[model samples]
Structure formats: structure tokens, C-alpha cells
Target chain A: MTSETPIIVLVRPQLGENIGKCARAMLNFGLTELRMVAPRDGWPNPSAGPAAAGADSVLDQAKIYDTTAEAVADCSHVYATTVRLREDTKRVVTPEEAATEVFNQAGRSAFLFGREASGLDVQDVAMANAILTVPINPEFGSLNLAQAVILCAYEWSKTQSLSQPTLTEQLPPAPQQDLDGLIGHLEAMLEPKGYFLPDSRADATRRTLRNVLTKPGWNHLEVRTLRGVLSTLAKRDRK
Target chain B: MTSETPIIVLVRPQLGENIGKCARAMLNFGLTELRMVAPRDGWPNPSAGPAAAGADSVLDQAKIYDTTAEAVADCSHVYATTVRLREDTKRVVTPEEAATEVFNQAGRSAFLFGREASGLDVQDVAMANAILTVPINPEFGSLNLAQAVILCAYEWSKTQSLSQPTLTEQLPPAPQQDLDGLIGHLEAMLEPKGYFLPDSRADATRRTLRNVLTKPGWNHLEVRTLRGVLSTLAKRDRK
Candidate 1:
């Protein structure tokens, strides 16, 4: 279970309430390990105890430390969560990507969210191999600490697949007609230009073009871009 | 901005920490209103203070009610988050779809997630207009309540205009329209054979053909297959 569960660390948490909430988020995502560093309010703070809700077990058993380093000392992998982007950080990951890494860890991994107001100091962020950032609207991106934990926990939970899903949930969206139209346009323009002529050879050309576009998911913008390229090429052939 | 916020109602929340964390997730998404229904330990539990960390403001302002309906009384819409799919309840929605509703809401809406262990009873889900469920791996879909809040938050965040996303964040392209042309070509062939001409006027036939091919988000493979069909038809026509 330790392999799957990430050890959640709070470095210099200034509030008891935040710690309690973080613990709650941890429990929500199947993570039970809680570690704290230099909490402002002393452990067993009455505020934190009741705030933990059903996650009291995590709060009760939470391991406290004097520093971020000490709290994550036992962790094989550590991630620091922050909203601010830094110039020098090594691995910058979205919460989902970070969770993917945590899911892959061989031993105990720790996800650290800093204090309430100031957030994790740059020095503390450097302690972990990776930094996890939530993509928020830059205009109003002040994500609270517990919010960060919840996002992290949510991504982790998705990987676990805890509930049965309906048929729509199981299947991806069906493909549409726009793609075929564009390809047909390209082929129509190309057929007379010798791009694909022999009736049998046309099949191979069409398959090769299809293979190139279908591997990764595409959206309207990319489709437009590809159409532009094809139109340019087709025009050149006309010339 | 209660209008844009998703209401987080905890039903019989057993611990202060869990409630605090839930509050944390709400605030992160700019959701501040919280309602608790008969928390086992009590409202304004002291333990929640420290656990709330930076989200103390959310905890400080939390409201407590006697029932789920009371908690959602002021909201225009509500979605209950549940792990179990009860046999009797109807109107279930995936969390992603729920986020879409919250984003589109003309007024305030609430997304309710239940407590740990036993999820929201069927009666609770029946109270809401829709039931919100997350699609997990199924093998391990049991998500903690706070984690559910986080996932909702993440999906909502994606809709936010958070600067231009990196190229990698781009979704797959919808299939182009070349396939529709192929379908049209085939329909034309069938029309000559009286397959759809006499009984179906050509203009009416064309409309039905277009309707059959039109889909919301088609991808590259789909268009290619249509083109392949056209190619086969061309080969046969040549023979």
C-alpha cells in the first residue's frame, strides 16, 4: 500500500485548520500518511482535531517534523505544490502529471504543500525533485493550501478507479465527419497531381495520411492547421 | 459569487478535518459557501481551525443545516456526489458533465459530496436534480469525499481561461468533412441503382445522408475510413 499511498507533508503550516483539512484531502484520495513540519499551532490543537471530520485517524496519527527536509527524509519521492512559477525549478508538472509520477513510485512518496499565506518558500521548493503547480486563471489564481491538496488527491483517486462507471463513461467520444472531408479534399486535389494515382495505390496513401493524424488526440485548431498545409500543397501542385 | 460556485454540502460529516479540507477545495475554486448537515462531532469544531490552514476563511464562514435540502435551499441547482450507484435513483451525471453545468449556470449551483465509508444514501441523491459520479478505473473507484471535491475543482479549472495552454495540453482534432463527401459519393452511386432515388428524392436523400454522417467530434481515423470506402467504391466502379 505504501507503494501507492503518498506521504503528504505540510512544511511550516501556520494554521491547525489547514493541517486538518490537508489530512482530510489525503484520506479522500486513499492517502493516509500525514507529515507536518514546524506547525505554528502545537499538535493536538483542538481546532485541527475536530476539523479533521472522519479523517481524524490521519490527524491523530500524523507525524510531525521540525523541517521540510526531516519530514520528507523517509520519502523516496517528494513533490512541492505551489501556484507560482519559478525560473530554476527542475521538473515542473501539472497536478495530474505529478500524481502520475507518484503512482509510479516504488516506495513512499511525499506531496508537500506549504503554509497558508506565503506558500512554499523557493528554498523549500528546491528540496523536492519535482514541483507541482495547478493551472489556475492567472488573473485570480490564489489557490488555498487545502485546495491544492484536494486537486492532488483528486488526480490520484482517478488513477485508482474506485467506482463502477456507466457505458458512456467507459467509451471515448465517437469520431466525426470533418476529418474525412478534409482528407477527401486533399485527395481530390492530389489525384490529378500524381500524389496517389493507381487505384490500388490510393488506398495506401490514404492509410498513411490517416495514421499520421489519428495517433494523438486532435482538436479544431490542429485540424485547421493541417488543412492549411494541405491547401498550400494542393495550390503548389496546381501551379 | 455564489452564482458561479458549486455548493459543497457534507452530510453527517464525522470529522472536522475532513470538513476543513472540503472547505479548502471549495475556496480553491473560488467556492466559499459550505453547508453541513448534522456533523457527528459538532459544528465549528475547534479541530478544524488548524486543519483549514490558509483556507481558514472558508472554515470560519461555513454554515450548518439540519438537512441536505436546507443546505442547498439558496442554490438554483444541486448535484450529489456518490460512489455507489443505487438501483432506484435517476438523473446521474459524470463529474466532468456536472462541471459543464456549473460553468453554464445562469445562477448559483451546488455540487454535494458525501462523507467517508457509507456514501450518500439513495434518498439523498433523489433530493438533487442530478447525481454526479466520477469515472474511476473501477478496480479502485472508492474516492474520499475531499478527493471528489478536488476532481470537480480540477475540471472546472480547465474551463478557466488560464492563459494559453502549452501545445501538449491541446485536445485531439475533430475529424474533417472529407468523409461526408465520400458518403455522398456512395449515396450517388446507390441513387443511380434506384437504391434511394425513386422512394427518396435526391435532395431529401442528400439531407438524410448528411444527418447520418454528422457527429459532434470526429477524429482522423473516421475520415480515413470514409475515404477508404470511397476508394473501394471507385475501384469497383472502374471494374
Candidate 2:
């Protein structure tokens, strides 16, 4: 197992059995860490143990989060498994490509898989740097949650040796928390200017802004510079 | 959806739900042809339809055979999925390599996956030209039948366009029936000469013979030539 292996984050998963299955799939490809965001059923469901099929350790160490933001706070690269047609600006990638990029880049990555039926919502997708979609038969594309997770895990395993220890001196992308702080600062400044006017379209506008901001994958230093710029711009308003 | 997609053959599969899951996995990757040999509960299993998760077309078109030999009789290139540790002479390849070769080679190919619990028997493995092994985590390698099938199907899908139609001129290896016929003929001739002595070791000896014979992948003409030679030698012995 590599240190940079992406963590699997299931957002609002419905069933304990499915969660257990996802863990089994991840372990099969050598992925260990699992995080869940607000599961419908509370953690430590007795049903999960029998379904894990001997991958108990993954479930045992799985960390629970109150929200997706908190789950991926430390993750520098976040990928959303999109189940719906989205016209967002986020770049869509196949599992194979996502694995390659994750291995080559220096960062802690997390792949967010939404609820089994509905998949990620607009807010959840807005947090991702890229959309990961599996190319399936257009006629019959019915990959279950575990199946989808396994494919991504398998692809990631294939590129396990791709990252060299000193391949890049550049810092990895800033963690999701830092990026959120930058976005939050910008939103606060823009909110008073009527940039998000019309309550009906405010959600869409915010999502678009997030899509654009997250696309840059700014490093920690760049994010700090941008924050400083925002603070300076805000200071002029007080003056 | 290429015509040369390898057929998935399950030999002596035990469960109906697993068969259905396999169908779903195969369809997700554009593989529609499914063959089964000696399913424990018999064909048209009632339980399979529900588990297919709307991949009914795949299950609806599945073909059944009484034996592994017949299941792959029309297939030109036979690949056996070995689940156990084997020190056999046959070449073992990863699913990716098998997919590449299958696409490049001009032949109807078949992949033989063994029973859910006990993978293909020695005799079944001997029937194959090569072995297919998934490179999984050594410690926690718990890939169920559907998981294994999906990984293979996923890998096979990756090389869908790798084969250009006009690349090979040499005829594809003769359909498996031709090879089996040749083996049958040679076996009959050698049976009277005490070639397979010691009843306890006969099965191993036969497997060795099959492994040697299948390795060559002789085309129709080559098989025909060998058959004629066997008949001629038999005639001389009778005289």
C-alpha cells in the first residue's frame, strides 16, 4: 500500500451492507482508509460485520464525519463520482485517468461516492476538483455501488508504483479546508455586491463559482496569497 | 460491442445469484456472450433474474453446456482462470494482457472461470491454452465471483479498439473442437500402448498431455495433418 492512496468517502450511504461491500472492494485493491459522511444508519451496525467478508479492519478503522466538507478537510485532491448529467465546468475523467493523475501528483486524495441511489448532489459535486465517470454500455449502465468502487480501486492499484518519492518538488494542492476558506472569503466579499442576486439562481451561481475556483488546484502558498489579496481588497472597503 | 469479444464461460458454477451478478458485470463492459457448464441448480434459474439487476438481456441470451469442453468448443482461443496455486507449464497472464491479445488475435475467444468455491479443476485448467490471474493484494485477496468477472470485463473493455481489423493474416487457432478431436484421436492410439499406466496417475498424465497439445494452438490444417498421421499409424499397427 502506498501512502498517497486515495481515501474512499461515502456520503449519506443508505445501508450498512453496502458500506461493508465497499470496504471489501477497496481492500481487494489494497485501499485501506474509509470515511463515511452521515450514513443513514448509525455507525457500528451489526449487519456490516457479516457483510464485510473478513475485511473487518477497514470497517473497524473507518472514521465517521458529520459532513462531506469535514470528511475531506485534509484531502488535497477530491473526486466526485457523478451519476447524473451535469453541465458544470469541472473536468470529467475516467477511473483509469483519475488513478493515473492521483499517482503522479503529490497529494492526499479522496474519492467521494454519494448515496447508492441518487449519487452526489450539486453541493457535494461542487467540492470536487474533477468528476470521475466510468464508461459503460450506454444501453445498460447499471453498475452498483460496490462495483463502481471496485473498478476505481482496481484502476488505482494498477498505478501504485507510478509516484516517485522526489518526482515533484512543488507542493500538492491545498487541503479542502484551505480552499473552502478562500472560497468563503470571496463569497462574503461578492455577496454584498449583488453578484449572487435573485434567490432562485443563487445556488447555481455559487456552484459555478466553486467549479471555477476548484479547477485551479492551487497549492497552499497560492491559496495563502489569494487570501491575502482578498483581505487587502476588503480593507479598502473599510477605509 | 466488437464481434471478437471473448465469451465468458462459467464452469460448474454453484449459485444462481452469482450468475446474475456476473451477467450484470459483463454487460457493463459490453460483453454479452455468456456460457455455463453444469450449473448446480440447472439453467433458467429463477433466483438469477432478480440478482441481474436489470441485466436480463445477458441472462436471457446465456447458453448452457454439459461440460467445459463443449462450452468452449466453438471458441478458438481458450483462457482458463486459475484460482489456486499451480506450478503447471501453461503460461499465466494478467487480465490486461489477455484482453490485449484477444483483441489483436483473430479468433473467437473464451475465458473459463471456475466454480465459486473451488476454481477450475486440473482437467479444466489443462483444457486452456493459458491461465488468467488478477494481480490483487496478497494479504486480503477476497474477490467474489462478480468482482473477479467485472475486473476482467473492465480490463477487456480497455483494449476494445486496440485491434485493427487487418493486422493478422495467419488463420486464428482452429476452433477448440478441432483441437479436441485431434487429442481424442491421439489418445485412442496411445491408450493400447500402456502410455497411461498406473490408474492413480492417469489423470495427471492426461492433463500433462492436454497442456502440451493446447500450447501449440494448431490451426485447422495443422490439426487435420496430425489426425491423418495418427490414422495412418493406427492402420499400420492393425496390419
Candidate 3:
């Protein structure tokens, strides 16, 4: 479990049993860390025991917090689950892709699920570095709290290696350049070419482009090819 | 839109916003009937108006119910989504399989998602002839409320014909033992055989057996034929 283990933070969960069941799901994928933020019911809830089935240990050791930020404060990375799409939201990942990144990151990670009623308010979603959404039907896309966690956990479990350290660690970072630096170079090339109009929107567009490319777990070869394409476009515009 | 159109049932949803969002998901798949079982904030909730974005019709025509049974009373079939698995729970169908079954039934159907954290209680699941579970990772399987409904709605939408349906008045129910009955019969048959012995605890064996059969979509005739073979063996044992 070591570095691969994830901390599950649930904000304002309305039901004690859901907290318990979330614990059960985490155990299924060999994850244990649990954090609760301002849960509707008091912690150490008796209702959680039966619902957790045999995963009571997770409930026993769960940490409590007053805010979403506090729940994930110790983690190096955080992913917020949301059903509705926000136009201004940056760094959105489909649940499958987020799992890969979560497994690859070197430090502790946390995934947050909000209350049953309103879900995570925009404020909660904004707190996270990334937004994680399941590719659900545009119509009727309401998912229960525990179900969302299971999908993420399922994806993470799939990427786990048996003999190898972890799927994420196997690749390591490219010696030549990191994802952010390469993205920055590409955006610089595009900026002069009017690839993204309006100075105010340039950063957002570049970030969106970078977010899309990063989803595939790009390598040196792919990044170089992308950079080359940007260079060619830049030269043609200048001519 | 035929039985192929999956119905969305919000069981005792406390918040009107969730009910509205759930209706929006249904509308995404061209489903319109929104059944609410004892909503906490009452129907035509003002909070739901904005959260639904542009799905006011779903709230406008929403149907309210006193209980889950009442919510699904008109439908020929029902499915409940639960967070944790119970021993006596009906056979679990993945969202995809449930979509296919809905198409086959050629009858009105309801898929129930319960209150945020508690999920569907055992009685709730039993009411539905079957339990529908989204294929989540075994570990950390918490699904946000709207997201769960979205997945089922998405799968249900996929099986639909994009073209406008020619007016067909009625269709026959496909002949098959529903998954719940077939699995029960299979478990009973296995019990007499050494497949599940005094040493192998019936509950564990039952869960394992259900898990195996639940993966692939089994039609009614195929399930009946398998049960026939089991019945024949049981006959010999009785002699």
C-alpha cells in the first residue's frame, strides 16, 4: 500500500453508513486512509459498523476535519469528484484517466466526495488541483457517493503492478523535460502566432491544451512531436 | 419510448435539487417520467430550478411517491442501487446489463437510487426484482449521487435507436427467468451438490456463484435451460 495508498475524504456526508461503506470500498482496492469533513452525523457512528460490513478498521482509524481543505491538507495531490461541468473549471479528468495519474504520483493522494444532496459546491471543487468526472450519460447523471469512489478505486487497482513497484513508478519522469515545461514552450510558440486570441484567455487555452495532452501520459517522443507541430504552425504564420 | 427507455426513481430524496438533476439526467436519455418518493424539501423546489440548468420540464412534470414501492408501482420492473452488498440481495447487474434487460423487457421499468449515504436498504433492494451496480473498483468505491444515475442513464441511452421510433403500439415481454430467480435456483441446486458443502459456507458460495453469472448478460431461455439441468439432478437426489 505504501505510497500507492490513497486517502478518501468525504465532505459533509449526510449518512454515517456511507462513510462506513466508503471504508469498505477503499479496503477492496487495498486503500485505507479515510478523512471526514463536517459529517452530518457524529463520528464513531454505530450505524457505520454494519454498513462497513467487515471493514470496520478503516472507520476506526478515520480522521475528521472541519473543511474539505483540511481533509486533504496532508496529501501531495487531490482530485475532486463532480457531476456537473463548470465552464471555468480547469484540469478536468475522466475517472479512468485520473486513476492513472493518482497511481503514478509519488506522494500521498486524496480523492474527495461531497454530500448526497448538493454534491461538492463549486468552492469544494475549486479547492482541488484537478476535477475528476466519470464519463456518465449527459442525461440522468446522478451517481451515489460510494459508487463514485468505487470507480476511481477500480481504475487505480487496474494500474497496480504485481512484481513491479507500481505502474506510475515504472515510467519515471522523462530525463529531458517535465510535462509543465514542455507545455510552457508550446504555449510560447503559439502565443505569437495568434493561435489563442485575447491575452487574457491565452493562459487558459494553453492550460486546457496541456491538460488534454497530459491525460494520455505523454512520453518524450510524443511531446517532441507536439512541439514540432507547434513550431511548424509558428513558422508558417510568420511567413 | 418503449421499455427500452429506463425510468429514473429518486427514493425519498431530501433535496429538491437532486430530484431536478436526476430528472435532467433522464431527459439526457429522452426519459421524462421523474418519480420522487417523499422529497424532503417538497416538489417544484426553487433550489432545483437553477441547479437543473435548463431542465425545468422534468421538475414541472415530476411524480411524487409515498414510498419506493409506490414510486415503482406502475412499472413492470424495478432495480435498486445499493452501496454495500447484502447476503440476501438479488443478483447484481452492471449498468450495461441492466440497459440490455430494459430493452428486452418491452415493458415500463424503474431504476431506484436511494438517499445519498445510506443507499438502498435491504428491503428497498428486495422490492426491485434486481440490484444494479455500476462496475466500480473494489477499493474506494464511493460514487457521487448524480454520477451514479448518469452512468445508468448513459448505458440506457446507448441501446436506443437514434432515429425517431415508428409508432408501435405494444410488444411481448421476452421469455426468460430474470437474473434473481435464476441465480436463486442455481444456488439451491449447487447446495445439494458438493459445489457448496457444509465446509464451504452457503453465503460465501452464493456470493461467488452470483458474481460469476452476473458478469455476462444471460437471457431468459438460457437461464431456464441451465436450471433444468439442475432440477434433473435434484430429482435424482430426492429418489
Query: Which one is best on DockQ?
Result: 2
lDDT of 1 by residue, B1-239 (tens): 22265667888888888787777666666666777888889878987877565678778788888887567655555677876565422356777678776666544577776768787854456455557776543333445677677677768766554343223232222322343354556665455445443564655445434323332223445556546544543342221
Q: After superposition, how far is residue B157 of candidate 2 from its true place, in Å?
A: 1.8
- Pairs in steric clash, model 2: none
Better of 1 and 2 by TM-score: 2
**TM-score to true structure, per model:** 0.49, 0.81, 0.44
For model 1, residues A99-216, the per-residue Cα lDDT tens digits are 7887776877788888898888887888888888898645445566776786777677666655345433222322546567666776665565555657788788778766544542
| Candidate 3 lDDT over residue span A145-168, tens digit each | 776776676556656643345545
Relative to the real complex, the DockQ score for model 3 comes to 0.04
Model 1 RMSD vs true structure: 16.4
Where does model 2 sit among the CAPRI classes? incorrect
**TM-score of chain A for the candidates in order shown:** 0.66, 0.66, 0.67
lDDT (Cα, tens digit) per residue for candidate 3, span B1-239: 45556678887777767666676656655677678888777776888877675667877888888888888887887988865666763688877688899988867888998887677766678788888876554555656466677667666765776522222222222243577786777555444345554674857656655654553344444455445433442332211
- Cα TM-score of candidate 2: 0.81
Residue A35, candidate 3: C-alpha displacement in angstroms = 16
Ranking by DockQ: 2, 1, 3
Report residue A147 deviation for candidate 1 (angstroms).
Answer: 2.1
Please tell me what DockQ candidate 2 reaches.
Answer: 0.12
